[model samples]
Every structure is written in C-alpha cells, then in structure tokens.
Target: MSPNYKFQGWMGLDKDAAKGKMVWQEYTPKPFEETDIDIQITHCGICGSDLHVLRSGWSASLYPVCVGHEIVGVAVRVGSKAEGGIRVGDRVGVGAQSSSCLKPDCEQCSGGAENYCQNHQTGTYSSKYPDGSKSYGGYADYWRGPSHFVFKIPDALPSDVAAPMLCAGITAFSPLKRLGAGPGKRVGIVGVGGLGHFGILAAKALEVDKLVALSRTSSKKADALEMGATDFIATDEDEDWAAKHANSLDIIICTVDSPKMPLAKYLRLLRVGGTFVQVGAPEDRLPPFNILPLLAKDLKIAGSSVGSPAEIREMLDLFAKKGVHTWNNNVPLKDANKAILDMDAGKARYRFVLVNEKHVSQVERNEARENKL
Candidate 1:
C-alpha cells in the first residue's frame, strides 16, 4: 500500500541556505523499489557535513537539497525484496551511505569495506541513485532509501541517542576497533567536538588504558573529562604541550574538521610505530608540514570516512551495553533554520538532533496552513 502521508521537509534553494535561509515545503523523493524501505523519521542528527553541503563547501550541491544523514525512525514501509530482516513496525537507522555496488566482483563490498566501494556508492543525501534519481536526506518527516543500508536499532538504545552513532559514532568507532584501540593501548582523541566526543566515548568503552582528549584550549576540558577521558590537553594554551605528551599514545584519532590546526604537533603525540587515523575532513586543502616525526618516530598518518554497516551495528551494541550517553540536545524540525544558524555558531553543547513531532496527512497539513494564514 502507498503511504497516505505526503513527503515534505525543509529545502535549501541556494548557497545562502546555510545561513538559515532554508524554506519548508514539499519535495519529491526517489521512486520506491522492491529493495527499498520507507522510514517515518522521528529524529535526525545534524552533522558537520550537513553545514558543508548546505554551503556547497565540499562541492556544488544540487539545489533544493535536504541534508541529514544520521537518521533514526520507525520502518513505515518495507519492500518485499528488502533485506536486513526489517519489518514495517521495526525501529531502524540509516547512515551517510545509502547504496553500494554489491557485485560479487566488487572487492570492496565483498570484502566488507563498502564505505570504500569504488563502484556506484551513493550518499544518503545530495547524491544520485544508479537510476539517476536525486537522493535526499533525513531532514524530513519521511525517508526512502535502499534497504541494504537500513539497519535495525537495538531495543535497548533510544532513537535520539542511537541517531548520531550511525554517522559520528561509526566514524570514530571504526578506526579504533579496526586498529586495536582496546586494552593495553594508550589512545588519544583530537578535538572534543561532535566526532571527537564520540571517539573518546568509544575508546573509553573499548577499555583503553589511557584516554586523552586533545583540543586547542581548556574550554572543553571539563566536558571531556566527564566523558570518561583520563586526561585532557590544551595544545594552544600549554607552551610545551607537544613535548609534554610526546610519544605517549599508541593510537591517535583526529576528528577536527579544520586542517589549519597543529598537524605536526599532533603527530608528535604518537609513540614509536603508532598509527594516527584522521576521521575528520577540512574544508580547504591541508597545509604543508614537516615529515620529520614520521621518519624519525616511525609514525603513520591515515584517514577514515564513515564506517561500514557491520561496524555501525557493532558500535550500537557496544554503546547500548556501556550506556554511553551522547552529549546532545533536540530542536523542533520547524526551527531547522535557527538550528542551522546555531550549529554554525558552534552553539551545540555537543550535537543537535532534529525531532519530527508530527506526521500529519496532507489535508490536515493544508488545514493547519490555512489556520496560520
């Protein structure tokens, strides 16, 4: 049966949309297929990538885009060909990735590295389907995408709390779990913002011996410590911060989005043969730095995007078991403009999840519009 409700959400018409200029209205979603599942979204976490897409920072975004990838809601519709054992009434989630070429010959997908799928990987929003249909995001009351990317949320985790983990949580969790961040390891998380906070939580949950939160200043020292950090470092405030913590960590997860920060200094925090994984992306190209630390200390610098679906599932169970509370607040979907402006101003204590409080029929929506007029 077709949905009785219409698809409607906030849309950014131009580059100025990032400046709180998005308009609320109805928009077309991708056509449904047997492998697709429709979600009546209850919560969507606002990510830094949302702002980048809204302002065309990453690249020129297709106009009238809806930008949110950390999605959580109930499965209102499930296609017959859909996988993941999802049912219409099941609570579920979708991350940054919506589709990947799952050909048997596709080494990335077959090898469980779908995030690095070289063929036909589609983003949840601001991307195109293989059929050339425009893909939208979760900044709406409903979301429709391929079932391969939809995951069932664990019964123990709340939807609001589980939302960010799909994206930010996995982004941090993957490198740590993959690179061995647990017991006997001394882990360092760079930047205590959205992604960094999750990194600290994940590393702590993984039972790292020493979990240090590195940032530019002491403003977030109290917050980081409360998030299970064993120590905190203000790189800019302490003159000898780099030397003070030199060769102390076994692995470092860099989550700061800006490249202008201290790259060379961060590399110095790593011990001999340590691995540094950068999970954040800077808007502009990164500046040059000396490779002296890499040569002399045998340090390795790497990068990571969002994680694969399997990694996301693992992260969910870990967070649920550990009772990891994401430091965040909620905003009504109607005030998305103000929310975007506030997010740009760095006002979020940690992260913001947009709440879709109503899923009314079109007639009811029209009646409410008339009443407002």
Candidate 2:
C-alpha cells in the first residue's frame, strides 16, 4: 500500500452541502506515518455532528469535509509503529476523536482523561493536523488515522448496532456510569431518542433500582419499557408529571438537545443530592436555568462529551456480554444524502447507519483499491 492512494467519498464543498448537495469525488488523505492505520469502512453511523460540520453550525468548518465519526471496519494496513496493539486485518472502530496529545506532561493524557485533553485534540473530521493536512471522516471507503484512537469491537456485538454506540452510546453511557447509577439508585433518562435509549440500557445494565424514561408524549412509552426502563413519564400527557416524579430519581441524564426543554421541571425530578448531566449538545443557549431548585435540593447539573477510548472498550465489553443493542435503520452508503435529511426530520426509529456493502462484499474488492497505488 502506498501513501498516495486515491481517497474518495461524499465531500461537502460548502455550507449548502447540508441540503444533500455533497459531491462524490476523489480526494487525497493525509500522508501516513508509522503510527497510523488504514481501515476499510464497513459501517458509519450518521450523527448530528455530521450536519453541524457540513453547515458550519458549531464553528467554521474546514470545507470539503467528509462528515462522519461513528466508524466500524477491518484494518487493511497497520503501520509498524501503530499503538494500541492493532494489527493488519483486525476489526476495529473509531469514534469522534482521531488524535490527542499523548505527551507525559499533558494532564488529560497522563490522567486517563484523553477526552478532555487541553493541549492538542483533533476531531475525526473538520480539523487540521499538525502537518497542515485536513482530517476526513468515515463517510468514505476508507479511513486512516493514529491507531491509539481505534478500538477492537467485540465479536458478540454486530457491526451495525456497534457503530452508533461509538458516539451516541458512549455520550450517554459515560454520564450514567459517572453519576453512580447502579444498584439502589433510581435513574431517569430525559428524551426517548438515540442517546436516551442508550442511557436507559446502560442504567439497566448497571443494575439501577429503577429506570424511568421521560419523553414529551406517550408515543414511546411501550418502546421505552421494552428497552428496560422500569417506568415511563410522559411529561406532556401526564398532568403534574414533574411533581409526580419530583424527588424520585437519584440521577437524571438529559439527552434532549432542544433548547426549550423543561429545565426547571427536569431538575425537580432529581432527588436530594441527585445529579443531572446533560450529554446532548444544543445549538442554542439552554432555557433559563434556576439556581433556587439546585441550591434548595443540592442538585448538580453537569455536561459530558463522548467518552475516551478506554471507556468505549469497557462499554463494548459490557454490551457484548449483556446483549445491549441499538434500534437502527440501515441505509446504503450511497443514500447518505437522503439519510441525513431524514434524520434531521426525525424519521429514524432511533439511529441510522450507513453500510458500505459494496466495499465489504469481497476481499478482492477491498484489496484492489489501495490507498497508495
């Protein structure tokens, strides 16, 4: 394999790319180093971040971006100095991150908190590397990056289900695990969408005394219960729902990214000394938060991002052993444009995964397309 392989994928040339205007064109990946690995992408989960980058919603995005992070594939080439014990042909996964400063003096790296690395943090896409090359994402046939961020997917977990877990699942799982959501603890998951569903499953896996699923309407009540939630709270349909469940939960993980969420009411649902962690990223400022409720009850409001690679490994192991699954709607890689629009319109049952069936069908098909010809 050569470093000059023709990389091709759906590239967003400008902000209008968010409206399904991406162009499928051949491009070039960053020059590889001994610490890198090339993956033949089999599945890439569509995330809200993809849309954000395409439209520069979060910040000025690097144009011509290939937006996707939740990636799963088989390693096609492993660099001699690649970290993480990765070898050629190993099935691995990459999430939102591609690199972080691993220097010994870095607080986050040395403290096992790479997610919060302050010195240097490179996203899987829409960022620049130290060498002045732009980072691409998994929306392509292949992905190349440092092996330290790649993780081995457990065999028991299917690739499709495991793809979304790379981002959405870890985003929710980290907070639940951090907030002491285990046996004897009553937990509530706000919103019944992708991240919330994972919160419900993780809480159940942690053996929480009770798990309550909260949503605006009763439409997802049955689904939530099936996902291992011990109870359901329909905020819009049930009168005094907040008061009814007030001081009932020991920990609450809010997964709704909408800015208009009932912040005060959600806080009321927390028990004394209970914690409320927001894992969802809202585009707008959160609704006016009140300090009264927080001070009166000693409630804690915190935020979390996607977990570190170590945390992802732990989550995958637990999912494989406990049979954790995601309710996903699969689409072909060619339909990513349609999939993104559908996802923005809330058409997914829970999550969406783009499968590169054409690339994964045969070893010859994969091997014939080398990154370096």
Candidate 3:
C-alpha cells in the first residue's frame, strides 16, 4: 500500500470552527512505521472533545486539528510488526487513544492500563507522535497509526452504534462494570444522554437487580425505560426526589458534565457504602460539598477516563454476549458540523455517529479495482 493516501476531513482553523465553520481539505498523516495500521474509516462519532478542540476550550488545541475519537473502520493496511492481532481487511475500531509508550518498565503500560500511560499518551487528534508527526483522527477518510489501541468490532453490533461505544459508551461502561454493577446491586445512571444511556444498557446487560435513570426532568422517562431502566427519577419535578429515593442505589454513574449539578442531593440518593462515579469531563471545577455525607455513609466519589484497550475488548465482548446495543442517530460524515451542533444542543436521542459511507464504498471499490488490476 502506498503512503500516498490523500487524507481529508473537516479541519478547524480557529475557535470559530465551533460555530459550524470547519473547512474540508486534504491533510497529511504521520509518516509510516512498522507498527502501524491504516484504517479506512466507515464511521466516527461526534464527541464533546470535538467541540472543545474546535474552540480551544480545553487548554490550547492544535489548530487545523480533526477532532474525533470514536472510530469504526476496516483495516486496509497493517504493518508487519503491528500488535493487537490486526489483519488487513479486519473490521476494527479506535477509541480516545491512538498511541502510547508500551515499554515494559512503564508503570501504566506494563500493568495493562494503556489509557493512563504516562509517558506517551497521544490522543487520536491534536496530538504529536514520538516521531514529531501530527496524529489525525477518524473524522477523515483514512487513519493510520499504531495498532495497540485498535480492537475488532463484534459481528453483532452495527458500525454506527459501535462507533459511539468507542468513547461515550466505554466511558460509562468502564466505571459501572469496574464498580460491580451486576446482580443484587441497584444502579443509577444520571443524565440519560449518550454516556448515561450506555450506563443503563450496560447495567441491564450485567443483570443488575434494579436500574434507575436520573435526569433533570421526566422528559427521558420513556427512552430510559426502552434502554432497560427499571425506574426513572425527575430531579427537578419531584419536590423531595432525593429524600424519596434515599439510599436506593449501590452505584451511581454521573454522565452530566455540567458543573452546577446538585451534588449533595445526589449523594443523598446513594445507599451506605455506595459509590458515585463521575465519567463526564466538566470544564469547570465541581461544586463544593460537605464531607459529612460521604463520611457518614461511607460513600465514595470517583472519576474515570475512557477504558483501557483490554477493558474495551471486555466491554465489547459483554455487549455481544448480552445483545447490548446502543441507540444512535446516524448523520453523514459531511454533516459533522450539524451533528456536533445537535449534540451540543442535546438533541440526539442518545448518541451520534458520523457515517463515512462514501469513504467505505470508495475503499471497497479501490480494493476490488486493485485486485482486478
């Protein structure tokens, strides 16, 4: 395969890109390496990070960055020394991470925690590789990078639904599964959006005794029930919602990134020794809360980033085995700007996937043409 592939996608030149003004053009990918795989992108999910990068919301973003991480595609090329069991033509996916230093001495890498790999944790976009090449993302026609972060997509899940799981789904599923959200445990999923929806589906698949969906209003009640929630709580509508559901859930996954969320009241809904995990990355500092509630109930407040590759594989397997599927709205990759805007406005039913149908069809055509040639 030639490195002559002309990479192209929506590029954010400045903060104004957040206002739906990304320009599409050809871009260069990192130089080829023996440990790389070139994925012909079929779908990429629009995440909050894409919005943040377009506007430089989270620190300084690399300009002209193609920001997106939830990627699903077919491996068109695989390097000889690439790891991760990748093969040419395999349907695969990449998550928030693209590359990491895999040295055995590295604490994070050696321990099967590549997501926390301290030394060379490079994001899929707006990041630089060890070779000083810019790392592009899946919002493009092709993505070339290390295979360490890539995993095969299960046959049961569609590309659109599987795409968001690479980011939003795993973000919630990891903490929920890690905290033991299975039989005999009551779980609550706050925010009923992409991440929270996955939390509800994952909890149900894990066979939890009871699953609850928590949102500011009861607007999501029907959707939550469809996603397998056994109960729903409208925090704003009910006067004493917290008191009424006091000590009800063993685990709570907060998917809402809003800084102004009612913290103490949410804590009140937890049972003794219950754990509250915040998976959403709020830009602002969290609201201050008294420690009395935590101390009294022996409760825990924690935060989780995306899962490790091993963990992602485990989650994918679980989803396959339990028939867990995501509720996703598909938008053409060309309409990414509109999709992101809708995501920002909270319009998506749960998750959004940018389908690169043209790219996928082109790849298939090219493959057939090359064989004929």
lDDT of 2 by residue, 1-373 (tens): 5854457899999999999988888778888898998998999999988988899988899998998999999988888999888887788999998888989999888887798998888899998777878899988999988888999889898889999999999998888877777899999999998788889988988889999999999999999999999999888887789888788999889998777889899999888999989888877789998699989999999999999888889899998998999999999999989988998887887999999987668544655776447
- CA error at residue 268 for candidate 3, angstroms: 0.8
Lowest lDDT block of 10, candidate 1: 358-367
lDDT winner between candidates 1 and 3: 1
lDDT of 1 at 201: 93
Give the per-residue lDDT digits (tens) of candidate 3, residues 1-373: 5765678988888988888888898898998888888998999988888888888887888888888899999998899999978898889999999888989999989998888888988899999999899988888898988888889999898788789899988898888878888989999999888888899988898899999999999989999999899999998998899999999989999988777899899999899999999988877888899999999999999999999999999999999888888898889988988888888898988778899989778767977998999
How does model 2 score by TM-score?
A: 0.95
281-351, model 1: which lDDT tens digit per residue? 77887657798879998889899989988898888989999999888889988888999899889888798
Q: Let me know the TM-score candidate 1 reaches against the reference structure.
A: 0.95
Model 1, residue 142: distance off in Å is: 0.5
Best-fitting candidate, scored by lDDT: 1
TM-scores for all candidates: the values are 0.95, 0.95, 0.95
Clashing pairs in 2: 2-372, 5-371
lDDT, model 3, position 285 = 83
